[model samples]
Target: MNQTFDVQGMSCGHCERAVTQAVKALDAAARVRVDLATGKVQVETDQPREAVARAIAQEGYQVAAA
Candidate 1:
């Protein structure tokens, strides 16, 4: 599944890496693209959207409710 999430608190490369890693932790094969400027996170994964969002949230970022 592909999902786009509105995530805040991302300001640098580290933030992008954090979000990507968080998503990857859930599904090793998942693809994550974080656009800090737009506060958008695009993810392609087999996991559920909730699980992916929770992972990003657990990384200290705010995942806006969709």
Candidate 2:
């Protein structure tokens, strides 16, 4: 499934990497793209939306409603 999330508190490249890594930890084949300026994260993964959101939350980022 493909999901787009409004992710807050991503200020730099490290934050981007952290979010990507966190999702990848859940699904190794997942594809993650982050737009820091827009605070949007577009992910293509097999995992459910809730699981992905929780992973982002666990990474210390807020996942806004889609």
Candidate 3:
């Protein structure tokens, strides 16, 4: 499934990496794209939306409710 999340507090490349890593940790094959300027995170994975959101949250970024 493809999911788009509204995230906050991402201000740098490291932040993007962190968010991407967080999602990948849940699914190695998952694809993650982060846009700092818009705080948008686009992910393609088999994982559920909540699970993906949790992973991102665990990385310390706020995942806004969809």
Candidate number of the best lDDT: 2
How do the residues 1-66 of candidate 2 rate in per-residue lDDT, one tens digit apiece?
889999999999999999999999999999999999999999999899999999999999999856
Q: Write the per-residue lDDT of candidate 1 for residues 1-66, one digit (tens) a residue.
A: 789999989999999999999998899999888888899999989898889989999999889844
Candidate 2 ranges beyond 4 A from true positions? none
Superposed by TM-score, candidate 3 places the C-alpha of residue 31 at a distance from the truth, in angstroms, of 0.7
> Which window of ten consecutive residues has the lowest lDDT sum in model 2?
57-66
**lDDT tens digits by residue: candidate 3, 1-66:** 889999999999999999998889899999998889999999999999999999999989889864
Runs off by more than 4 Å, candidate 3: none
Q: In candidate 3, how many Å is residue 16 off? A: 0.5
Kindly give the number of clashing pairs for every candidate. Answer: 0, 0, 0
Can you give the TM-score per candidate against the true fold? 0.94, 0.96, 0.94
In terms of TM-score, how similar is model 3 to the real structure? 0.94
Q: RMSD, model 2, all Cα superposed?
A: 0.7
Candidate 1: the clashing residue pairs are none
- The CA lDDT at 15 in model 1 is 94
Rank by TM-score (best first): 2, 3, 1
